[model samples]
Each structure stands twice: as C-alpha cells, then as structure tokens.
Target chain A: MTDRLSSQFAFLDEIDRLKAIERATPIGDNSRPENSAEHSWHIAMYALVLADHAGPEVDISRVIKMLLLHDIVEIDAGDMPIHMAHDAEAHAAKEAAAAERLFGLLPADQAAEFRAIWTEFEAAESADAVFAKSLDRVQPLLQNLAVGGGSWIDYNVTMDQIDTRVGVKVNRGAPRIWQFVRARVAPFFSASR
Target chain B: MTDRLSSQFAFLDEIDRLKAIERATPIGDNSRPENSAEHSWHIAMYALVLADHAGPEVDISRVIKMLLLHDIVEIDAGDMPIHMAHDAEAHAAKEAAAAERLFGLLPADQAAEFRAIWTEFEAAESADAVFAKSLDRVQPLLQNLAVGGGSWIDYNVTMDQIDTRVGVKVNRGAPRIWQFVRARVAPFFSASR
Candidate 1:
C-alpha cells in the first residue's frame, strides 16, 4: 500500500512540471503565456461549459477526462503550436515516448489506463476524443481572439491556415461550435488583412 | 444558437481571471504562487490518480467535476487560506453571490448544473463530494511539503493546525491518502522544529 501511494505521489510531483510548460497562446489580457496545466484546466472547463455544442454521441465525462490528460505530454514533448512547422513524425514519436514515461510513473494498472486515454485523445478516434480534441483546438483560438489576435499575430497566422488546421478538426466534432468560431473569427482576420 | 455559444464563451473568458487569482501556496519549485485555475487542474488530476484511495461509494467522475468547479468562486470572492482567520459568514455570502454570477454566465441548464456541483463541493455532503474536498485539501498540503514547508513556514503554521484543518477532512474521505500525507509531513515539521 505504501509503495503504491509512493508511486502515485511521485507521478503527481512529476506532472507538477506541467505548470511550467508554456504554450504560445497568451492568456486573457496578455499578461503572460499560459502554462500547459492552466490551459488543461481551461479546456476542461470548456468541455463542461460547451457540452451542448458537442455531438450527442460525445460522453462529456469521458471528454473531460481526455481534455485533462491530453496536454500532459506537453510536459515532456513540449507544445507544438498548430501553425508552427515541425517534423510531424518526430514530434509524434517524442510525444509517444513522453506519454509512456510520464504515465508509467503510476501504478501499473493506472499507467495503462492513463496511457490509453492519452493515446485515444491523440488519435481523436472516438466521439469523446474528437470533442475533446475540438476543445483542445478551440481554447487557443479563443485566447487568440480574446487577446487581439494573440499568437496569430506572433506567428503571422492567416485565415486559410487556421481554417485548414483548427477549423477542420473542430467542425468534425462540433459543427455548431465551428459556426460560432467562424462568426467571431472572420471579422478579426478581415480587419487584420 | 449564437447567443448560447456567446454566453458560454463569455463565461470562459471571465473565468480566465481564475488563473490570475493567486493562492497562498507556491508550486513545486517555489518560483511563484499557484493560481486557482492550475490548482483546480492539479486537484482534478489528484482525483484521477488517487481515486483508489477514496471510499468505495465515491464516484470519481463526480469528484473530478467537483474539484474542477470548486475554486471558481474564488474568482469573485477571492481565495481565503484555510489557516487564515476570516469572517465565515461574509465569505460564504460572497462565495454564494460569486457562484450565482459566474455560473449564471452559462446557458441556463449548464449554469444550474455547474452551480450545483460547486455547491455540492462546498457542502462536502455526499461521498463524491467528500472525496473531492479531500483532494482539494490534499493538494496544497502536498505542494507545501514538496516546497519544503512552503506556505506552512510563511503562515507560521504548526503540525496541529494541519492535522485539524487538513488531515481530518482528508482522512474522512481518503484515510490512506491522509496517512501518506502524515508520514511525509511529520519529517518536515520535526526537522523544522
């Protein structure tokens, strides 16, 4: 029992590092770049608040779990902003390895469960995973809009890029939410142009 | 449809303020105080990783939801440290109003659900709520221990204070976890003395 709790506490301690893994998206008011831990919290809240926007098939509880676990790999693999060009194969490999190492810190059964959820989220295969992925995309986009084109301005991101990269995934999971995003985002892109 | 989504987004933007509301406890590295939002995320993770320690009657999903929604009221009423002295009636009144205004930003149904979860968490009545409240207390204790008596030193906190204020609640919901906390924390206090 002691050993089991020790392993769990170690895992908890390690993931506290997630609080330091900074994302490109500046928080509301643009005080600083949001850390992965806080971003995870925000997107989990997004899943709760926007559950009505998800497809009927999405199980919100599972979606919330996926959102909470998704970016934890960022603690080890580092966050790759969607607009940034990177080696997809290499980053995927790094993320896979990170997931194994981080989740492996837990007891064996929990490690398997957590690693599987993280994999399911990465695959975006299930309804819950898709909705979770959509939220994962939506948060940064919302942050960008909130902070006067945050990160979009920094990365020189364009509408076409956002459409293909973020819109497609979000629309696949939640079309109504995609419509809402387009309505709010179109003006920003047009004004910037 | 747009109106519904707009209210949700507004709530999301408003709660982003939670990341700015600093807690008394510093994070693992002692670099800065942890904010309410990230602290929420960490405790939700604690619910996930420490679910086994909770009572059999506790539902982990509800506990996670409770943890996520628990501190949101702090955005409005401000965080009152457990060890600090404050007027209970005033704080509770302020927190109730905060819950109403903040969760009310969601669509009507979601607003009610989120507010209820927050209330349940505050009440700590059900098994799930009890476990959720335990994680909420457990997290700061863990953080303080990790940072070498982080907040305990600052607040001039003593062993008895922690036992009454944190341990009893954690033990009610998760005795094993409370045991783990006690074993680790004893060494810190002993050394400090």
Candidate 2:
C-alpha cells in the first residue's frame, strides 16, 4: 500500500511541472500566459457549470475526468497550440510518447486509467469526449474573447482558422456555446480579416 | 440565451482572478507558492484519483464539485492559511460574503448551485464533504512534506496543531492517506519538537 501510494504521489509530483508549462492564451487579467494546470482547472469547472448545454447522453463526470487529465502530456511534450502547430501528426506522436512516460509513473492500474483517459480525449469520439473537447476549445476562446484576442492577435490567427478548428467541436458537443462563440468572436475576426 | 451565457462567462471571468491569489505552500517542485486556481485544480484531481480510498457512501461526484468550488471564495477573501488565522468565525463571515458575491455573478440557477456546493463544503458533515475535506488537507500536507515542510516549517507549525486541524479530517475520510501523512510528517515534527 505504501509503495503504491508513493507511486501515485510520484506521478502527481511529475505533473506539478504542468504549472510551469505556459499555454498560448493569456489569463483573463492578462497577467501572463495561463499555465496548463489552471487551464485544466478552468475547463473542469466549465464542464461542471455548463454540462447542461452538452449533448443529451454526455456524462458530465466523464467529461470532467477527461478535461483534468487531457493536458498531462504537455508536461513532457510541451504545449503546441493547435493554431500554431505546423504538423498535427508529429505533435500527436510526441504527445503520445510523453503520456506513456508520465502516466507510467503511477501504479499499474492507475497508469492504465490515466492513459486511457488521455487516449479517449485525443480520440474525441463519444458524447463525453465531444463535450470535453468543447469545454477545452471554449476555454481559450473565452480567454481570447475576454482579452480582446490576446493570443489571436499575437499569433495573427484568422477567422477561418478559428471557425474550422474550434467551431466544429463546440458546435458538435454544445451548440449553444458555438452560437455564443460565433457571435462574440465576429467583431475581432472581422476587423482582423 | 445570450444574457445567461454572458452571466456564466462573467462568473468564469471572476473566478479567473483566483490564479492571482497565492497560498503559503509551494508547488511540489518548490518553485514558488501555488495559486488558488492550481490549488483547486490539483485537489480536484486528488479527489478523483483517491476516491476509492474515501469512506463508503461518499458521493465522489459531489466531492469533486465541492473541491472545485471550495476555494473560489479565496478569490475575494484572499487566502488565509489555516495555521495563521486566529479567528474562525471572522474568516467564515468574510468567506460567506465573498461566496455570495462571487458565485452570484453566475445566472440565478448556477449561482444557487454553486452556493449550495460551497456551503456544503463548509458544513463538512456529509460523507462526501468529509472526503472532499480530506483531499483538501492532504494536498497541502503533501506539498509541505515534499518540500521539507515548506509552509509548516515557515509558519513553525507543530505536530499537535496539524493533528487537531488536519489529521482528524484525513483520518476520518481516508485512513490510508492519514497513515501516510503521519509516517511522512513524523520526522519533521520530531526534529522541531
């Protein structure tokens, strides 16, 4: 029991480094780029608070689980914002390797569970996964919208890109949030375009 | 729909300020003090991962909700470390007021739901609340223990104080974790005593 608990704690310790892994979006206050830890935290809260808007069969608890573990890979692979990534395949491969190494620190059963959650999130297939993905996309979009497209401006992100990447996921899982996104992001993207 | 969505977003924006509210304990790495946002996130993760160890009949989902919303009041009341505060009643009043104002930023339904969760955590009578409280206590204790009693040593915290304040809670909700805490923290307190 002690050894197993220590392994779990070791895994937790490794992921604490997520706090230092900065994401593309600035925090709402624009104090600095938000770290992955708080990003996961914020989206988990979003999942619970907005679960009603998700698809009918979506399990909110599962979505929250996926959100919490989704970014653990960034602890090793480092964050490559979807907007900035040049090659999706390469990024996914790197993240997969990182997930194996990081989650591997846990005891066997926990390692399998964590890796399965990460894999399920990456697949984004089920109702829960789709809703989890929506919350994930919605968080940075909210951050960008609140801060007047802080990262969007910095990275020169365009409307079509946002529509294609983020829009589809938000639309599929939580159509109401997609409506909000389209309406809210229109002005900034219009001016930029 | 737009109005309610905006209200929800407004609440989300308000809680983002939690990232700026720092706590006494450092991250596992000892890099710097952990902020309330990450602290909330870490503990929520802790609650999920350690749910099996909690007492029977505890509702894990409810406990997760409690953990996520627990420190949101800190966004307004600011973090008062358990070891430092001298007045419990004064702290509760400030936190209750803060919870009202902060959670109230959400739509009426969400505001009520959030307030209920926050209030439940404060009461700490339910099995879920007791379990949630255990994760809350264990997180900082682990952080402190990992960094060689980071906050405990700084605050000159003693074994008796920890026993009264944190040990009892951890013991009730998760006996295994309490055992780990006792074994791990014993050396530090022994040296100090």
Candidate 3:
C-alpha cells in the first residue's frame, strides 16, 4: 500500500510541472499563453457544457476523461504549437517516449490504463475520441478567435490551415461548433485580406 | 438552437474570467498563487488519480463534477481563503448568489445540473460529496506542504486552524491522506519552532 501511494504521489509530483508547460493559445484576454493544465481544464469544462452539441452517439463521460488525461504526455514532450511543429514524425516519437516515462510513474495498472487511453485518443477512431478531439481543437480556436487571433496573427496561421488542420476534426465530431467557429472566426482573418 | 448555443458560449466566456480569479494557495513551486481555473483542474486531476484511496462507496465521477464546479462560484464570489474568510454567513450568501447567476448562464437543464452539483458539494452530506470535499482540501494542503509551507507561513496559519478547517473534512473522506498530511506537514511547522 505504501509503495502504491508513493507511485501515485510521484506521478502527481511530475504533473505539477504541467502548469509550466505553456501552449500556443493565449487566454481570452491575450495576456499570456495558456498552460497545458489550464487548457485541459478549459476543454474539460467545454466537454461538460457543450457535450450536447457532439454526435448523439458519443459518451460524454469518456470524452471528459480523455480530455483530462490527453495532455499528460506534454509535460515530458513539451508543447509543440500545431502551426510551428514542422516534423510530424519527430513530434510523434517524442510524445510516445514522453508518454512511457511520465505515465510510467503511476502504479502498474494505472500506467497501463492511462497509456491505453492516450493511445485511443491519439487514434481518434471512436465516437468519444472524436468528440474529445473536437473539444481539444475548438478550445484553442476559441481562445484565438476570442483574442482577435493572437496565435493566428503571430504564427501567420491562415484560415485554410485552421480549417484543414483543426476544423476538419471538429466538423467530424461536432458540426455545430465548427459551424459557429467558421461563421465567427472566418470573418476576422478574411477582413485582414 | 442558436439561442441555446449562445447561452452556452456566453457561460464559457464568463468562465474565461476565472483564469484571473486567483486563489490564496500558490502552485507547487511557490512561484505565484494558483488561479481558480488551475485549482479546479488540479483537483479534478486529483479525483482521477486518488479515487482509489476514497471510500469504497463513493462515486468518483460525481466527485469529479463537484470538484470542477465547486469553485466556479469563486469566479463571482472571489476566493475567500479558508483561514481568512471569517464571516461564514456572508460568504455563504455571496457564494449562493454567485452560483445562481453564473451557472444560470447555461441553458435551464445544464444550469440546474451545475447548481445541484455545487449545492451538493457545499452540503457535503453524501459519500460522493464528502470525498469531493476531501480532495478539495487536500490539494491546497498538498500544495502548501509541497512548497515548504508557502501559504501556511504567509498567512500565519496554525496547525489547530488547519486541523479544524481542513483536516476534519479530509479525515472524514480520506483518512489515509489526512494521516499522510499530519505526519509530513506537522514536522515542517514544528521544526521552525
């Protein structure tokens, strides 16, 4: 029992570093880039509030779990901005290694459970995984759109890039949110042209 | 449908303000005080990680919902430090009102669901609520302990006060954690004396 508790506490201690793992998305105010922990929380809140908009067949509980645990690997891999990370192959390799070391801090059963969940989310095949992916993409997009496209402007992220990279997955899971995003966010970048 | 989506989005916009509502407890590094959103996120992660330590009868999912929404009211009421919020009556009134206004931003069903979850957490009567309350108190306590008693030293918080305010609830829900806290945390303060 003591050994089990130690493993759990060790994992908890490791994730405290997540608050320092900054992401590309700014807060709604554009004061600073949101940390991965805050991003996970925000999108989990989104899962709760906006689950109704997801496919009717999706399980909201599983979606919430996936969102909560999806980014734990980022603590080890460091965050890669979607627009900035050039080599997709290297990114995948780094994250896979990170997942092994970070989740490995947990007791055996939990490490396996979390690893499985992370892999499932990465696959994005199941309905819950699809909706979870949608929430993940929509959150940064919302933050970007809310702050007049902070990352979008900074990274020179074009709408077509966002539509292709983020919107496509969002559309697959929650078409209504994608519709809302296109209607509201498209105009800001379009007007700049 | 648009109007419903509008209400949901409006609520999301309001909660973005929570990132600015700082709490008394610092992050594990003692660098800066954690914000309500981060606090909520951390504790929800705790629920997932520590649920096995909770009483066998407690429902982990319900506890997670409580921890997530319990502090959403803080976005409106402002965080009253556990050791500092003296006028409990006024604090309760303010938080109740805040709960109604903030959660009310959701569509009727979601609003009611959130309100009920928040109320249940406040009541702390059920097994799930008791366990949720334990996780809530433990996270900050762990934060303070991890950073060599950051808030405890800053606020001049006493062992008796912690035992009364936080330890009591923590004991009811997760005695093993409370045992861990007492053994580890008491030494830090005692050494200073």
**Candidate 3 per-residue C-alpha lDDT over A1-193 given as tens digits, one digit per residue, 9 for 90 to 100:** 7777788878887788788888988888889889888888888899999978987889887888888889988887888888885788898999999999999999999999989999999999999999999988887877887888778888898889989998898999999888986887888878985
Which residue runs of candidate 1 sit more than 4 Å off their true CA positions?
A: none
List residue ranges in candidate 2 displaced over 4 A. none
Query: What's model 1's TM-score?
Result: 0.98
Residue range with the least summed lDDT across 10 consecutive positions in model 1 chain A: A48-57
- lDDT string for model 1 (B50-83, tens) is 8888778888988888888888999899999998
Candidate 1 residue-wise lDDT, A96-193, digit = tens = 99998999999999999999998899888999998898889988988899899989998899899889999999999988998888888989999988
DockQ of each: 0.83, 0.71, 0.66
Tens-digit per-residue lDDT, B1-193, candidate 2: 8888888888887788898999999988899899999988888888877776877798888888889889999987889988896688888899999998999998898899889888888888888888898889888888888888898977888999999989988898889989976888878889867
Give candidate 1's iRMS in Å, 1 decimal: 0.8
Query: Candidates 1 and 2: which is better by lDDT?
Result: 1
Supply candidate 2's per-residue lDDT for B95.
Answer: 96
- Candidate achieving the largest TM-score: 1
User: lDDT score, residue B172, model 2?
Assistant: 86
Ranking by DockQ: 1, 2, 3
Interface CA RMSD, all predictions:
0.8, 1.2, 1.2
**TM-score ranking, best first:** 1, 3, 2
